[model samples]
Target: MSAHQTSSPAAEAGDPPPVPEATRPVRARRLPPLRRGLLVPAALPIAVGLWIASLPRVNVDAMGDLGLLQVLPVTYFAALGLLAVGFLAVLREPRVRQPWAAGYVLALITVIHATPSALYPALRYAWAWKHVAVVDAMLRHDGAVPHSGTLDIYNQWPGFFQLNAAVLRVTGLHSVLGFASWYPLLANLLLVGPLLLLYRSVTTDRRLVWGGVWLYFSVSWVGQDYFSPQAFAHLLYVTVLALVLRRLADRRRAAAAGTPSARRPGAFVLVVVLIAAIVCSHQLTPLMLITTLLLLAIPRRNRRVVLPVLGVAVGLTFLWDSTVARPYVSTHLSDLIGALATPDRNATSGLAGLGSAAPGQVFASWVDRSLTATVFLLALVAVVRHRWVRRTGLPLMLLAPLVMLPSNNYGGEMIFRVYLFALPAAAFLVATLLVPPWPHRRWRAYASGLVAAVLLGGLLFGYYAKENMNRFTAEEAAATRFVTSVAPPGSRIVSVTSSLPGGELGYDTHERLVLAQDPLDQRRLLLTDPLAVLQSTMDDPRITGPTYVILTRAQEAESRLTGVFPVGTVGSVRAALDTSTLFQRLYDGPDAAVYRYIGPGARPSPPGSVQP
Candidate 1:
């Protein structure tokens, strides 16, 4: 039968005739709620982070008295106003925007609370807590050193310290405890959003993202260390990677053979800015990011690869040398390296330990080796499994943890700060595994619901967990608090000949500490040479007069300085010595007894002086 002449199916056999295919219309995909809600919580974190980064102005001299930081009321009010506007703008309906909005509120609380605490140790006196006491004492007497010493203990990360001080100034908060109190909250705030973003990027399943962030922050390192710039660096590292991934996805879409739209010039600018931010903040992050670009680019066309790669590499290399590397290479190599290595049974070691091959054999041996091994295997898997990661736009699955090898498991804890970029990447892989896929048509509520359960749990555990380095022990917190109490302004204290400041029960020396001198000689200096405490103090022309010194019980024998000259002691110190041996065993008395040296006026006249 001719097609048109054929009897209708319904007429011929009681079946209805089929409708023409051309008449059927396609239904458009409904957007996912999680993706839609993402931009909501991000505003506050972005502003806070920018605020933190902007505090260190090139011309600003913030190291003096921090009277400038006391204006938190003004900032808080302004921030609150912005937050209210943002809230009202986004919160036209709570059911639609509340989850993301809630995330922002928490983030603000975390950052505002956490940064001040972290800044206290860095801004109040010097760039580091371990060396604060020594630097404070020296700075109080004189600003310059006397002898030709090989190193500058006061110099760690001047830019970073300066930035910290500026935060104190802008916030108008000066007291050390006051600043320190901001740490926990800020640390949590900075950490939470990136983690949430990471989770969202990997899986539309909110539960997985939430769970992963919770797990990530639950580790103690994320909390107590929250007060540190490293955490911010970690946040930045992840954010840049996220931005890169987003750009790459956009690039892929634009480059697709059938796409009508050309590549956005704005996209390239964003990529460059992100690369610049990572490099300006820290070296290893840019290095890791560049490595990711290279690995990811190997299969891509040259036109796509050349510019961003060059921009990131060249920009990062320049910034690394100018900001972090060149300055540190000069004065801090030996001490920094020593801190990077593990000490022996007595806890004193040499710079020889710094460059040693196996610094990870110390405290982080297991984690160092484990992370390295995992990254190595994942890198291979990344190459083999590259298509999966590529489609997902997440090469940090391998790059983040891999680059950490240079610093991980090695010397001082400071290296951890450098390696923080690895964490967000690690979190990416973890959240990806935990969350499930979300297609355009279907909303996966179970997955979304789980987001809060696991992540919040992980965050809580990470924030408060006993073993995680993020949270401080009572002793550790107490020690840091003590440092805050006594820290001086415009001082560069080098923790030398003593472990008293960084912690209460000093544990000899931490694996990451480099003493004022050879760590191996640290005990010897304390036990035999009372004057070792005075080396930085005496040798540096900066110490023209008297500076307060803290000597532990281990150094009591040398305390008298030849057992002949009467050692001047403060009343607070005398009371402390009289009160408890705990102070004697772990620390010196009167906060090790504050002393006022009247110089030649108080001590015997210099040899040339006639008796008055």
Candidate 2:
């Protein structure tokens, strides 16, 4: 050896001490089998981006997804397939790719959520149009008008409107309507942080957390994701839970460190502020918070933190409803109390009231029910089979929301809403069996990925299936606009169902009533079986008025799909209108027809206004 040369000491001494191949620096060799799995997540975003670019834009005439299925390009399905494949590929990868994989899944969710909005010229749903009107009213008046004929006491729950109005003011966005189509995408995206926080708090498994979050987005079908107060409230709900869970996790660490007294009052304060916001934002969410808190408190360890939060939730709900929204509460109180009288009846009515619905809607509804059942059932099996899921109290969280079901139909959907609330925990439980414990063999990892992909495919279908049945068209909106512009305020707006394009803001200037909404006729409405019900309601002095009787494509679809008329037919109603001299056409368009009902003793309508 040369005097200055630094040689391997073992070699110099003739001692052959070997270096392990597995322990070498990562860059010294090509990626391991597991690290190479990152290629899937790496390629996911690009494939998804290209697929989105290839899909057709939203068709403006359709209210939501109605008629959308026809125009959607093959690339739409390709995107869905790509997401499924990416999710599986990521799940199959070792820990090295999970962080990047999580990001990819979130990005995919954002794109999928915003698909309709990105594709459409106008907002997807008619209700979104009315939401803008509410914000406009709030902005112009700087306050809400109670029971404004079209908006109901939504003026009372004006926190969402207020928030949106503030955004409009700052961003100079012309209307909430334009952004409403993508509300589901954006609201869920915001929820990712809280959801991940909560899921991560309960479990150490990253795959389980990610899977549950994905499952939540997949199965959420309340349509509350549209630009509404409920969407904001849901975000608050998850965030509050996340904070609580984070606090619980902290306490666990502190106890282990012998510093259990460490405090974070700021977190509690933030939670209270959010609870107050929830109270003001929606009628039901505050109660839901209380229910969730109660569920958490049942486990003795959580009682201290949960009890105070529960009190705050109840107090805020009562305070807001009793004082600021007193009128709305009082008006709806009887209905609420009445609903509570027979819990079984209320729950059954709520569930049965969902109806098979129109054919497409029926398909969607069944898919929703099946998906929900499968999740709960899978959760049950996971809890029984896996100690990790059971000991963590995942099952308790899943059952907590069912308490809302016995209270009332909650506008004929309390049960479904409960399912929505239970979904997050349910998904976590479902993931227990699907994702294996870490440090497994490659074939096992691949198997887990394939299983997850199959489950994900089911989930994706449930998420987007509602698009076809819920959409409306721009022509319907134009006709509605003409009616509102020309017709006198407080004109009774008549429709067979509240499915018309203009009905969203009907409470603004018109006394609107859907014949199907008549308390006396719910049975017939549910069956869609009143052979001549429309004609009778129109002729009835008690129901009929000098009103604008408008029909839209959505109404026809609603009546047919829901079987809201005899044999689920809208023909009877349309035929009656065509033959009747009482209604003079006010506006006619491809998807909408507006009629001014000339009362029995009224003078003739202006000539040339009636359409054949």
Of the candidates shown, which would achieve the greatest lDDT relative to the real structure? 2
lDDT of 2 by residue, 523-586 (tens): 4553453324433445545342356778777676666655555443444555556667766677
Per-candidate RMSD vs. true structure? 15.0, 9.0
lDDT of 1 at 368: 41
Top-TM-score structure, candidate number? 2
lDDT of 1: 0.39
lDDT of 1 by residue, 532-563 (tens): 33343435544333333333321221122212
List the candidates' TM-scores in order: 0.51, 0.84
TM-score of model 2 (CA atoms): 0.84
Error of 2 at 528 (Å): 13
Q: How many steric clashes between backbone atoms does each model show?
A: 71, 23
